[model samples]
Target: MLTFVAAVSTGFPAQAQNDRATTTVDYTVRVNDTLYDLASYYLTDPGCWTVLKKLNRVADPKHLQPNSTLRIPLALLKQSLLAARAIAVSGSVERTLGQGPFLPLNFDAALTEGDHVRTGPNSFATIQLSDGSHVTLHANTTILIKHLRATVLNGIVDRQFELNQGEVETKVTPLKPQDRYNIISPSVIAGVRGTEFRVVYGDGAGAGNTAVEVLEGKVAAQGPNAPPVLVPQQFGVISDSAGNVGAPIQMLPAPSLAEPGQVQKGLQIVFEIAAMPEARAYRATIATDAGFLHIVNEIRAESPRALFDDMPSGSYFVRLSAIDRNGIEGLSQIYSFRRARPSEASAAATRTANFEFRWTEDAHAGAGAGAQQTYRFVLATNSQLHDPMLDQTALAGTRLVLSDLKPGKYFWSVAAAVSPNNGESHEKPASIRSFTVGQ
Candidate 1:
């Protein structure tokens, strides 16, 4: 006996898919659906039913239950797998084609060979290659896509990027072992195979210097005159402005977070790293990204701990690296933490159009207790708070007022703070409260 059931949540796009490197579609099986029907509907070819059935390991196409999710492979869609696009872009980002002037880079911009991309101060961009690899550009960085092409028959991609300045983090896909991927700087070249690494160009005190930090796999860094240096996992190498490559150096071991344990309730991020025997001094950088491209604050500590104060409340990634006595910075260890101030929503009256919003105080708890905290509040008509009607920050008082808001539904949220300065700190907002003005 066969039964057809349509769950409430079973509705989905007939052909919808996430924009991953893989070219595929996520389709939900409808009542009395079969592999042939899906293949014909999506691929326009019922002959692909066997391919779809084999891909999903379904022996009996007649037994497919309703509301079951299936991944429809796109092998029949030629040229779909060969795509070069930007997955995400934040802040002011620009791109140029050939000798043309730079234009604002769109989030769905399709990248190709010879395309030049740059990020403004405090901005970042992420690019996806044909082979599902990713390259994240740091702020104030410029990169040229030297080569991006793949053979349809072999699925071998050749991707090369030239970093004119600043930093870039790369995550290369390991699917194709024979694929060629390289990051070229002014002074050196770093080549990789299915790994994660970071390259910084002209970052050192000296000009035209390049640094390669390998986080996962081995990276071969070469200078013009020096022999190629292989940087294995947790190791790094530096090239001087003169294109002289230095020997590989061990990265600093990751330190366990001591302060702020799991969470903190202040704008100040108290960073305490577990001691390391080889670490003389530590450098800490807090950013909104795991790649540390969007850096907010940086501090240096003679010991294993550093303090970042006066930052607004928010989520941030703290990156720490050990500096040997020789002044060489080792590999980095990244940790994510939240510096938030909690605020409670105040009661509202509908008699008058005036509304006063109040929230709880910032109670700095966990290792560093008794620290004075601050407050920031936001009032919006939407939950996402795109363009808030009332956005106030650095407010010492726990209350806010809107004199003449029209009669409608409104949402409000508040955040605690430790300082007036808005660093890269991400203060998670308290749960939002809704209120009505006039009927």
Candidate 2:
């Protein structure tokens, strides 16, 4: 094996100390593998052979035993640069490539290292890394892509992001040895191998405060003033701008929605979560897809109710989360629902004629006029309709008339059920009406 003469006589550089402080990867020595060859192939600088010799305590730099392992500090390793693709971008998201001007972060925007991203108020953006990991940026946030690199020979990756401000939610893919996934905030650094977590840096209202919440796997949280601490699942940590990181605290549990309707058939869509013990506010988001890859709307509510009035009729998923006093969001729960809206129907009873009870609706109530429309009617002596005196289904007409009646108050309701040509069932919300029948 050829030897690096300069590496043998030279002293290690001061950078070696910084490199030693970083994570390390193990490389098994192969036939004809020397410190010189290993440094040339796997390291940024081939002349760092002497540093490798000192790190591995090698007796012979020119001849390395086959199958022996050598530890290489990650800081000294060489890696190829990569990019992240913007899969879903909405509202007022913008991006900057290097020193270039900021452009709108449209669909499938490719961002590389040194790029920066900022989201405006009431906006959102989601980017996917080369390894299938995802990072979602909420409104009013700024972040810099510090590093996005990979080493092919050792199959290790290094992905790091510097959070300037605001919040980011991440779903990191499982990591291997020497694989680093870190999000550095102003006050703290959160490092994880594989997890679903959230890191918020000076979330608008809570300036100078950095919070990390782990939903899955574990994270190593480090601050300037404290040693690294392990934060397990359903846990979080808070770090202040003063560089002090607090102990991990148990995160809030998922909140249950207050018995949401199985199928919403109204002009508006609404969700009300059951009040949680320590919740100060609630956040609800809606998406067309189950994975939430494309979010359509999001709202924050001080009260339990969250209303969304402009969504069209379709199947969707709703994710709910609670915020604590410190403005930290908790674990979330997703629920499925169907919205069938634009229901318009009216009911009335004529006293003169044969006690006619009639109702009318627009010809195209969700399903167009060409679709087959059916009506279902229920009548009872009680308001609750516990025991119906008249129960009718699959009737063709909108009006229902009863000939002779006793002197008593009665309650009834009717709904238009449209069977669309596309085979989707559409139900116009029913309206109950009351009238007195005289003998």
Candidate 3:
């Protein structure tokens, strides 16, 4: 049976109300329906069949199978030709698209002009524009996608975004001569072309300070009444809340990776950076995305490097920035990295009086020749390894031999340690093996 929600002149009734912030409505196919009919009713413009076809990738609008589903994109149905898409999201990120109420934003979600995006604490989102530019919103930030439009005939794209609060990182692609990308903060406007930059519009105590850091290419920052200031690579400017624009200052230099080419081992992915003068501390963020939509681990290290050990094995990116005494974070390049654990380990079968355990070695071990590995061996009678056990620590080498052991059934395992130091003590346990022994 086909279900229809009060067929009105605007086509079918919205089947499901998306509670979260989303721009598109889901519609189920019914009898005596054509793409043109659906578009005419819901979109109020039957001539938008081409846009609907492109949006839904429908080969034949006339042949929409019965009970088939379609997504009625409210953005395309609206007057705007371009929309911002959330390509990646993590944590509590939400958006308001078109007239739709705020809803939980997800990956690949599209937002129309005048849409708003807000991120909660520890939340992050990355949006991609039609021109291949990207904007990443950090935690506790709110931004409005004020305008996004493109003309197919002229191949011109014009975008405008407003950062209401907090920070955002932008990577703008090269645009056509007439194309434009503009970001407006509370006190200033930043215009860019084929550039990478970060903008911070403060809140609370930091209010009235709209800071712009140009990482690559250049950006033009201007106040409401002041002239534009050309900020080039590795430079920044701030517009105070009082409507006063400040002079450009040199941005903090990139901190060099201590061992950029080194493979990460053990549970902890350790990072070291060269010390920079006047650097009070270093902030490191690790993410799966190069743009760092959602950072998995973020830490502030007083030392030259940072260590992250709480994540699983996969390719990741590390971004390191310097923090001056005033808590201003400097610009840093994103570094690709991988966290790999030592190979799985196994123990010898059935042992009589003495038994030994061995495990694999990591190629990038230790300070030099090989990784410095310390092994911990455990021998227990039960698989649970509750009590009847001999726990040995600081066993140097791949194998450990235990003598004068009378056992019926014993379970043993080996663990590796990066060093003898007392920093973040977590046992990297290996696979356990059971053995039978006869006295």
Candidate 4:
């Protein structure tokens, strides 16, 4: 009777109950895999790597051991997926599921599911894929990501994505060797084992050429009737018209940074000089309506060099000139500058011997003008102002003081400088005023 009355009960364990309350998704680690790709594949969001790293307390995703288990929060993964699916189009609207107007020129667009992205005239859009891959669409480009998924095969999960495009930059970070991603262009097919690279298709008349730039990793570019090019910053230009494959050329270094001029008196001129393969020395010149003057004559030191400090406040044309090791000279585009008023000095007069000397700071010229400004005060025994002393008594700054008891008349003037504001005068202008320093 007691055996017949026995009852059987089925219940979950305490750990299972606690895990159910937390709501987690299980993921296994794979070879050559990173957290970025894993989070993107499982969570359907590229930015989820940040959250996954935080939740899992992973400092570095590169060292993830194969066959390790990861617990991902369902709520966080859902939020990330929604965010990734929402694309911002042209700073004017947000489009989800890829339904929107064509992307404008030089604009950006994001894609989730159901995105049939197309490019307008002279326009481009960059797509951040679900598996941490980036695809950039060149002008007149077309692309569609039909399916994205993570599947377990042989106890290993691999992320897969397919792309049909005009052009794209795919950066794949796979967890295992089995992870697969493919991009199919009009005339070329690209497959990534695990790497980062860019593929660009020409537009309009240039339709047949495909250019690929590898940033960090390697990629294989395959086309009909041609050997696969292992592009490593290596670009392959295939001619659609002739079916000829051109050799890959390394990209040139980007243009250097330049500063904008600010107007003080006329305009303050500031410029940066870039390094070239043959550049050896540099020289700068400034030309007023009166005449041309040398500003700088320095030996080449470094690239993207900076030239700043005070110069005379005046409206003058400025030019930076350079010389190569072969003595070949290159001139920069001519620019203009004007020094306003001397920020610290005003016009004044001083008397020497029995004559009166009137001197005023060139507010629009010299260091205060935001360019290098140097001043040299000269004292001559003749009024004709010829035969000046090579080592004549000179004064800098706004104030000039001359002393001598010579009774004969003397001529005096100032020469402004155009070098760095290191208080050294380089070139002098035609003396503006002539006065007797002594009677």
Candidate 5:
């Protein structure tokens, strides 16, 4: 799932965070490389070569030893403030400039330091940083952009987000040496250099705590007063309200989907996965994009079946993952599906007609619109629909008329068969209705 975040509170201006420690990078001194050239390439000003020479003690700037590494303080590196561009915004995503009132956020919106963003239930937003990193905000999440700055010369970005509550998933680009990416929660800060990971706070088992799960690279989960815990790939760490980091918790593997969600014809969309022995819950996310950059809805259930509310007839993608015991999420797999509208029917017994059934169809029910729905009518004495009295298929019209029925209580159902014209056929039955015939 595209797990984004929410913040119950916003942070003060990033200027208040100036006390963050200064950092540096190691630059290799290549052959024929002069200090002036290095300064011109990596520093904001080439004149900073004097400072570089003094720091590296390179008496002879023109003839530096090859393969020798020089320490370059980030304070002197060419850097610039950065912003996150809202590439995909879906549902009720709200953004606030600083501490101002939040307005509806939209695509191509620029989010910078001190800005606060949040997603209402069933909403999602994906924002791209200046460094090619993407952060996907899942439903019911909020985050405060504490810092967004980068050393443009070396692709070293420093991103610090404060998660007051909720969760987020990020796909981070490889960072240069000395770069950092950190998500601060109530109790701990989950930090990574270059990785795809998930961070959650104020939810699940560890309410008011922080949980960090590493999907690809490693993450250093550290609490306020405790030491850092290394969580490698497919591992997780949790920090409590007291700022004590837990041991490295093993993440559950990605669960396999029971069936492909290629076509759905129902009032509700359901996706089921194979049950996991240790999974505390299952999480499913729906989006229009395969990258899950525009997550539209999300659901969590104790069972393997994940059902979403009725959606319009359109194509969508769903991501499925398991939440482990520590309230940490596991690896997820994404699948695509097409939803067809109004998989329902109504039945009646007219005075003259034995039984009349009519089913709803998509408004665009014609060629080229791709909404041609055929139906199957089933009649049985039992609600289980077994031992059918009459089973009919390939009924193209919306109205079906049946005569010469026996006198008894009978149950009937109509299933809409939708052919998406993509070589896939699906038959989804509506709720069964019953009628009593005169004895």
Candidate 6:
């Protein structure tokens, strides 16, 4: 009798087929039940909401019906879960169209037409397209992914990515030749193969230029009414209104060395001075290979002034040092600056007797040590520390306000003084700085 029952159970083909066709999962939404939580419960992954929306073409998740039939793909659900887990472990995606800002990826984020994506400084982003093509947006770049699709047949994949304003390095891994990826800028369109390349864009005088450098593999760039040019291990530039693509410019081998004071012209350099305890007067110097040296020309009141006019057109090295009331010296890190040709009227009309100062407490350094340092501020009309019109002292972190400074060159310095009762001395170093007042 046991053998007969086992034989009957083993021969039940119809029952097995019915079991295979039966549905094991069903989900119903409730009031206040978010898509994230619903996806987590039924699909075992919250990110499945994105896949579900894409699959069903549901315009909005917030308006989901209380009961809707959603046919979930087991394979897609699993893949979405894995991708979400990877993104959670790593940093979130930052989208850049060509060279733009780093846009943080939110849940269920979608890209549409005419959106510019940009990466931040020292950051990058990766996007997995529907067509299985992956785009990695490099740092300090902007790129646009215009269109994407997945198909085995001859389908239209018309993409127009523009490097609107910055630089981007792209690596395209395509599954088939029928799929097309087009990189467009204001001046050039590069039809790429499975390759790696970097594109940069910049604007000047109401027009933009694009530069394309091929790193590996080859790309064909087409210009208006011109034949295609093959770019391999070479770079080319496209300018406005010309509609003519320049010949490929081969990259030279890396320079073996650089000469001292050889700064690139037209590069802007910024200098910041660390706060000092008792320093007020500062002097800056610049030296170029052409034997040109001068002080900063553009002087602003908010911070330290630029000492010299646009540097003589040459590569230059710059240095800045500060002097205090007691004639103590403090120096800053040496940096490089290059100035283009001086423009007309770089100096504006000058104003007199307009200035202001304030003091704030220093939080980083411990306060009120056994020997407290007092700051004595001294202001004078001349660079020489004499004929001072305003003088004052305050506790550390106290802002000393001064205003109505005449529009002219002036010198200022600070000295540290200690209380005798605490056996503290006033012989510590001081600081000095100079600036001009403008109308």
Query: Per-residue lDDT tens digits of candidate 1, residues 239-304?
Result: 677766677788776555555334445445567777788877887776654433345566668898
What does candidate 2 score on TM? 0.67
lDDT of 5 by residue, 227-256 (tens): 445678898877677767778888888776
* lDDT value, residue 46 of candidate 5: 89
lDDT of each: 0.62, 0.70, 0.64, 0.43, 0.70, 0.43
**Tens-digit lDDT string for candidate 6 (79-178):** 1201100011012345533355556654235554455666554344444443323344544556656544322112324344555565554555432433
Q: How far is candidate 6 from the true structure (C-alpha RMSD, Å)?
A: 24.3
Misplaced by over 4 Å in model 5 are 1-73, 76-78, 152-155, 223-227, 343-439
By summed lDDT, which 10 consecutive residues of candidate 4 come out lowest? Answer: 1-10
Question: What's model 3's lDDT at 325?
Answer: 56
Q: What TM-score does prediction 1 earn?
A: 0.52
Pick the winner on lDDT between candidates 1 and 4. 1
User: What is candidate 6's TM-score against the reference?
Assistant: 0.33
Give candidate 3 misplaced runs (Cα > 4 Å): 1-79, 151-155, 203-205, 259-270, 289-295, 300-309, 325-328, 340-439
TM-scores, in order shown?
Answer: 0.52, 0.67, 0.55, 0.35, 0.63, 0.33
Scored by Cα lDDT, where does model 3 land? 0.64
RMSD of each: 18.5, 18.0, 20.7, 25.0, 15.9, 24.3
Q: Which pairs of residues clash in candidate 3, taking residues 3 or more apart in a chain or in different chains?
A: 10-41, 20-103, 21-103, 208-241, 365-370, 365-371, 366-371, 366-372
Q: Candidate 3, residues 111-177: lDDT per residue as tens digits?
A: 7788999998767888877544678888888998876876432335667788899888887765655
lDDT (0-100) at residue 145 of candidate 5? 93
